[model samples]
Target: MACLVRSLCDSQPVARFQRRCGLFPAGGAAGEQYVVKNYFYYYLFTISAAMGQEVFYITFLPFTYWNINPYVARRLIIMWSIVMYIGQVSKDLLKWPRPCSPPVVKLEKRTTAEYGMPSTHAMAATAISFTFVAVTVNQYKYPLELGLMGAFLFSTLVGLSRIYTGMHTLLDVIVGSLISALLTALVYPTWDLIDHLMLNSPLCPAFCIVVPLLLCYNYPKLNHYSPTRADTTTILGAGAGATIGFWINNRYISDALAEAATHHVLSVSGEMLLTMLAKFLVGIGVLVITRQIIKNLALKSLCSWYKVSINDHKALQQFRIEVPYKFITYSSIGLNSTVLVPLLHKLLGLN
Candidate 1:
């Protein structure tokens, strides 16, 4: 099983990087790719792959915000936005392709058609895990070694899972992890400063809103269509929403312990555990309802405004339509997660 997985993952297609450097052979084929037939490893790897995906992110970030610490969540989302944007743009600029089918069977198809280098899965996994550790290392009374170990394990699992799913080569995984590490190192010094500015600076909201939208609008174009741009918009929109929401929570909502919330660890015991569970359930319910309603309303409104049929798939993909709808829908979810849901918790005695 190990050798089969290895053979499959190690096989590389001659993408732009390989073509220029003459690193990998150009003769690989989709038919020659090896598939994971064992049930145990297949399920394990599939679950690992999910860790770096959209569903995991949507749930994970909000869970941190509502249950853990908003200060940590805020920084995590910001780092995620930065790392993912750079990773996505790099993939398009580098123009790499996934491993060929014959030697590396791709179990997933949704992202297979997209360029694959410095895998975003690896980038996100590294960023989220290490960023969490970085933010909490000094704030909480936890074992630094334990936190580092957990981060490493989480990052390694997700990175290796990319290869197991045949979505990335070893090189892609390595580069992705390295890039995220470099980014985190570069940004960690300014974390305290950034946090201060975000929570206290009156101008932070406008900066957050304008910068991400501009990044989304000016995202690099690909020769052929890819989900990269739309995905980037979703990420940026969520980040912007979360940032502004943080600002609102601090500046106007003025919860007394708002700034001091990150000073300690959240203890989970009997009734506390139950309350946390309830909070997650109720909070997530509100978020889901918000997402569905806003997504539908935004899509329909944009479609109407553009005089495009709501059912027109290609028309909906147009820059004006897609960007606004995705941006609006996710931004609403982000805001609701950080601001509205917490207020609801306080009102409902979930706090």
Candidate 2:
């Protein structure tokens, strides 16, 4: 079955197009090699690809939530979750292969094994960058053209990075970008209504938690395993946790405390810069500790219930174990980013 799948993938027209675009010599004789034309692009696109990665998301989202504005942070996460979930699920449904490697030099090897029909990197970059522009235009005073230009640059870099890294074809990048833009457009009109419900309505928290969990559990399956489902769960879980945290802050927290979450400044002096740097360090430290503790606890507890060794990586990847543990760990991280971090700021006199 695997051989048949591989044969079809190699023979597919889309795959052939990608191979031709790569410009690498296919079926070369022994000792023949492909050389990079420019080291500058190799480094630049590598950095751009990092923007769509876990490390970037983990750092960027919390900075936005803790320092920039919680309202903006929540909207970015919501948009990201929608764009990424659809992209990931679509990859499984379509079951497209990455560009064939003999003709395509895969610079980033980690994700080469995953399906790459619609590039999630492109989707995420488009959604987050454009959504940031759309959601914050009214609240903050910035030139609209500058904001739009920034979004375009961001999306273009990420899209180009996917092709340069040989993880996705041009078709993948284009379609992924268009899909995210469409989703953002459809979702933008409801931002105010969603924001209102998330802050004030009692049903918001429950909806946030239940809907994501259900989606994770019912995630599409494949004969071959992929990280898409687990990654999607992590995203949805964090978004859910963040939403609940915002709701709690709006409901139970005092007026003064809630005000802290809403306030922002356009400029930062040297002193303020020092303070934000401190907050970023401290808040990230607290979040890391919180995540590790919860993750270990969740893993051990789940393993115990399932009668599997916590050290067994395979067992941990099972749907029952993977979904709950990742969901629990990231949700806690998300919750703390919105709720506890702000409280910490007050106690430490950083705010």
Candidate 3:
């Protein structure tokens, strides 16, 4: 990724520095080539956050406001924090210099970057977008196609911002977005499972063992497919439910969290835990009253939004399903799922 970015910086749309002979230093780059390069990289940087802000704001946060709950909020916030932390670590571990000055991007000022691969903004934004949408749709209900489009727009603009500000090469931002997104995707759900284990270990083993079996039992009658297909559908269903749950929780936090911020008597950790616990209580209550629509919604329903059939084995790996993106998925799942699920079994928390 770094090499690709360097190549881009050196080759196409190269931003000429001050010729190492300028009388005064410049804060921004100048020239159309540099502008293009930066814009491309910036787009890479802002993706997840951009997508997250839209889904979370329009779907999750507003819905939470209308409902007025906080347990979901706390969990969502913690998860978001996790995603943010992952982005930070990835940035440093990757240790690419900022493509440019990391400026407040504008139309002009094509600043050159020092290290430009894997734009942090892109990673963070993408994480936020996925986590927010994950929580929202997983938890509540929303228009699907329109929602995805909106998320895409937000992420795209964020990526563009990187370039407009001359903060990264196109390759840098693109690679960054992909790296962050892929990494997050692989990790978060596993995190949720780990959380579930730590919080509810005894039941987790049974739950993990049973859900798939039960899903297998009903696999044929519910949809009637082969083991491979049945397994795929079940996996999709669980994922869909998790995403929905994630969204419901995230939406509540994005808006109401600010209010919780006002009640900042405790440290960040205390406040987060207390607030999240409160949210969990609220979610439980809501589940009781709504007959657990948010809690029980099927991935089949979610799949309908994307025109994915429950039995479509290819879709799980191929289609752009709107999975609920929580912060834990970015951090915990990244670490836990692959290591355990492949070797032992997979369970769930909020992934």
Largest lDDT belongs to which candidate?
Answer: 2
TM-score, one value per model: 0.89, 0.88, 0.38
Q: Write the per-residue lDDT of candidate 1 for residues 8-48, one digit (tens) a residue.
A: 34555313222232222234465433333355666766899
lDDT of 1: 0.82
Q: Model 1 segments beyond 4 Å from truth?
A: 1-36, 262-266
> What is residue 295's positional error in candidate 1, in angstroms?
1.0
TM-score result, candidate 2 = 0.88
User: Model 2, 30: alpha-carbon shift in Å?
Assistant: 13
Candidate 3's residue-wise lDDT over 1-351, tens digit each? 987546665423323321211112235453333223343344443443344332332234323422333333333433444444344334434555544432222323322322345665566556555655554554445666666777667666676556544555666667657765676576666755644443334454345335533443332221221122222332333332333333333343233322222221233467656654554344334423432343234345556777877577556433233222111122222222112221221122311
Give the distance in Å from residue 109's predicted Cα in candidate 1 to where it truly belongs.
1.4
> Per-residue lDDT for 66-149 in model 2, tens only?
777777887898899899999999998898888766556666656755798789999999999998987677778788899999
Question: Which structure among the candidates has the greatest TM-score?
Answer: 1
Off by over 4 Å in 2: 1-37, 256-265
Candidate 2, clashing residue pairs? none
Question: Rank by lDDT, descending?
Answer: 2, 1, 3
